[model samples]
Target: MTKFFNSAMAALLISSTSIFAQVENDTEKPNSNPPISIETMAGSRGVMYQLIINKKFQSIPLGFFSVTNAAATWEKEMTPDIMTQAHLTYTLFKGLDISSGMQYTPVYGFRSVAGLIYSYVSPQMLIIVNPKVDLADDLAAESLALIEYRPKINDKLNFYSRLQGMYGFIPKSGIHNRSYIMLRAGLGYKEFAFGAASNIDWYGPIKHNENNFGVFVSALLF
Candidate 1:
């Protein structure tokens, strides 16, 4: 899996480089400020920090894109875990993108995967659907979804909430690999937000579960 993941990452990078070179002469200004979102959630369970990026290689085709989403967590009773997913995408149609990326977890180590992502994005609401399969041995499959809504309450504040979930399994044996659901709600002012948060995680085929509930503060940096 490690070897395959490295190869896939290299291939994607190389392909993207070539694509950018071909369009280097295009007469579009480069992006001045790439959008980046960062958040930190701490509770009775532990601390988790998340980073998300959606960037473009150029502006011509309007579909060339890159994404990096990652999270790291430290729990009181468990070993720290860091997971990352990155992929290059092209808009296949309205709100849909073909994705290929690397996924890392303590259980599976690293796996190269390919998948599709559908997104609905607006000022007040966001929805995403992502499903991918391992390109290496074991062929683990994973799916995830996230929904968020932040309606404007005034010029300086907004009501914020989000629900996110993910599940993974082995295709051949039909065994569950892992799953988790997380929820958050709060109020946002400028670049900071504070709210209540909860996380429920299940591990392995037996579905051993852990629960954490507490308050959280988060920040967004440009």
Candidate 2:
């Protein structure tokens, strides 16, 4: 009777060990499914004010300007004459991006603007290309090219200067060209930034004006 009981106990122990080994093997199996990609949320808001004084020496009027989420899908603002813009972007390579968007401004007399922009950012320089077409009553088109050089100032402050030129073609009118030089200074703390840019518009003939200044403050949130 003792031998029979010992044999039964041995068989029970072997069965339990087999079951444990099978569970371990199942847990160690490699998963063949790929990991899911996650999307990140980022947003920015800026408020700008411009004072324009023309060469005719007229009264200076305050121009309120604002651009919110300038790079995202549903970006819009009201300060710059009640303008709204929608953008879609695709990354072509590292540090380079291409974006296309449509802008509408009711205050500007129901005008639609379609534009393509390319931006390149590096440690020492920044470049932007913007080509736009006006798809409204007046068939007008414009292109702006800008280049900025980054200057290292400090940990919280930085300085840069840019040169931009704009050319416009209007129906029944000849080509119009304008060039501007801008100086920008930025102060950053955490996710908030304050920046000011001074613009000097140089109009080629036709009595173009000059000495226009704009200041802006921006905040970024994650």
Candidate 3:
């Protein structure tokens, strides 16, 4: 299952890049928004990388989006560990969508998921809230939320910051599942951004906690 999961992720990423290239090479432009973005951080405790894709079809009514998140600790610790999650969403309304995807965590392994997402975007801020359920033996409910703010400090530089968190638990047995919170604050120059980042994670019924703090760099990859 692990091998299959890894392979699936590689294929998904590769296909996304291929589609991006094809779109650029062809005269048919889909949307003005960048199709992909990437972020990486190296903290005192570990290193983290994340990729997000918001690809919209010109012919389709709405858009489809995907998110991939991962992190690794310097000491190879499992607490502040590596994880990945991806979701595909179809827009239902202006700021609401139905989404489903898969996620892999150290504690939960890999699980199939289905959910809903609502997003709000403006000139200086972006917000997203997602609620989902795990289609597993335990039957867990999960939620993730994110907020990003970028205000113009000047024409060439903009202030950047983001807050994101996730939590999940079983409804029947009331057993705790997993949770994490992440924060990033930096300065962006057009497609490039750099600054401080932090991650806090909690796992399982015992609610063990882990912390990581460090610097980060991000870019918009078209």
Which rank order by lDDT, best down to worst?
3, 1, 2
Per-residue error for 50 in candidate 2, Å, reads 9.1
Which of candidates 2 and 3 is the stronger one according to lDDT? 3
> Model 1 — which ten-residue stretch has the worst lDDT?
17-26
Q: Model 3: which ten-residue window has the lowest total lDDT?
A: 17-26
**TM-scores, one per candidate:** 0.76, 0.45, 0.78
Question: Which of the two candidates, 1 or 3, achieves a greater lDDT against the reference?
Answer: 3
Instruction: Write down the lDDT of every candidate, Cα atoms only.
Output: 0.64, 0.38, 0.68
RMSD of each: 9.9, 28.2, 9.7
Error of 3 at 97 (Å): 0.6
Which digits, one per residue and each the tens of the lDDT, describe model 1 over residues 84-134?
A: 777877678755778887878888887888888766555666666677897
> Cα deviation of 33 in candidate 2 (Å)?
27
Instruction: List the pairs of residues colliding in candidate 3.
Output: none
- Per-residue lDDT tens digits for candidate 3, residues 87-132, read 6668777557787778777777889888876665655666666678
Better of 1 and 3 by TM-score: 3
Reference-based lDDT, residue 125, model 3: 66
User: Which stretches of candidate 3 lie above 4 Å from their native place?
Assistant: 1-34, 61-63, 76-80
Best by lDDT: 3
